[model samples]
Target: MDHRDMRISDAERERVVAQLNTAVAEGRLTIAEFEDRVDGVLRARTFGEIEPYVTDLPVQQVKPPEESELRSRSSSLKRRGRWTVPRRLTIVTLSSSVKLDFTEAIFGAAVVDVVLDAHSSSVELVLPAGAVADVDSIYTHASTVKSRIEPSGGGVQFRISGEVSTSSVKLRYQRRFWRWRW
Candidate 1:
């Protein structure tokens, strides 16, 4: 028997479904195509049956980078709008301001690891809805860390770790209008 004849497990089927979801979110597939492919994946029972649904779709395997760093000495660093959020990010600054807005940013992974190293500066993270952050690993001296959003069990999480000396770090959700929280 060929390897393609092997039976497929639910996990394998769900992986394909996740790829299909990403495809639709990236606009690579229309809603109709995504629905059709998801339906096919649900019915697939063998490797051969699942091969065709994603044969033409591009692979979006999330591979985390070793470490990407952004260093600033006297200027402000801002990352906002539809940008790709690195799996591991290191922000180093001195006497500067840093703001990372993830409202429309693309997440390569469910959790983002941010390492902060600042002196006499301020760092702010503007998270989107349904996202939470963990900042317990950060070490602060003569600084303050504040997060308006409560940490939850699931969804997108930010693992913030590092040191902030004479600096501050804050986490807040994106606001819509002056009174709307959307």
Candidate 2:
């Protein structure tokens, strides 16, 4: 039997689903078409059966940035608009303000790991819809980490682990409407 005739595993199926997600995000497939293809992928029993679902799609061979670091002292740092998010990010600040807006950013990986080392600073992350963050593993000293979004494990996962001294870390969803500030 050929390799295509071999049986497929669940992990392989999930990888295809991830590819389908990327395709949809990149506007290569419509929502309805994605739904149909996902249904077919679920019903597929062999490699040959799943080949047609993505054979026409371009292979995503572009490697995302490995890691990113943002450091500041007595200054403010902000990231907004369309940008490629790396898998790992480190932020170190002292007496500064850092804001990361991910509403229009591209997620390179499903899981993003953030390491924070801050002192007397404020860190704010404005995430998109369906994105969740976990700040349970962070160590704080006279610092407060607040988040309105709960980590339910459905969409993109942000594993935040770090230490904050006299700092503040807040995670919130993007606002749909504009709010005027006086």
Candidate 3:
């Protein structure tokens, strides 16, 4: 997607700069290189402009199984009833704010239904749990979840230093009995 389409916010840019600074301090980037790249990021007006530099930086990796296999398995597993666990989650972000809520109870579990709403700015909906059986299920196939949930609770609030906004979030709860579920 185009950097303009990505709609990254100023706060996110600051965050990226902070991370870059850390990397430089740790010797991951030389002072001169750091200053140059940092300047580039600061000057960047779109996500596309900042992506090439940041995409290569060290980050976590998560990949899903082949789609065919996943679909076939999901279909077969659907018959078992016990093989799948469905949960309902409602996430609400306040005006001009971004939020993420994770429940330890569902940590590493499968998310069947994810509901998201955004009003302004950009929202990032992330599932960092390793226990989730199908990240693609909620993200790609279902499309209920977005790469970044936009700021929807209200308008975006620019904070000078303190908390910029408050996010109201909720996640539904359910458990599957399948032994291999995960």
Candidate 1, residue 122: CA error in Å? Answer: 0.8
lDDT by residue (4-89, candidate 1, tens digit) is 89999664677689899999989989999999989999998899998899999987676546568999898999988667778899
- Give the TM-scores of the predictions, in the order they appear: 0.65, 0.65, 0.33
lDDT of 3 by residue, 1-182 (tens): 65456867665686688778777777888898888888989888878788766775786232322121111111111122212122443333334333332322221123334443433222333332322322232222212332322233232111111111222222222223876421
Q: Which ten contiguous residues of candidate 1 have the minimum total lDDT?
A: 59-68
User: Which ranges in model 2 have alpha carbons more than 4 Å from their true place?
Assistant: 1-60, 178-182
What is the C-alpha local distance difference test score of each model?
0.87, 0.89, 0.41
Model 1 accuracy (lDDT, Cα) = 0.87
TM-score of 1: 0.65
lDDT of 2: 0.89
Residue-pair clash count for candidate 3: 14
What local lDDT score does residue 154 receive in model 1, on the 0 to 100 scale? 58
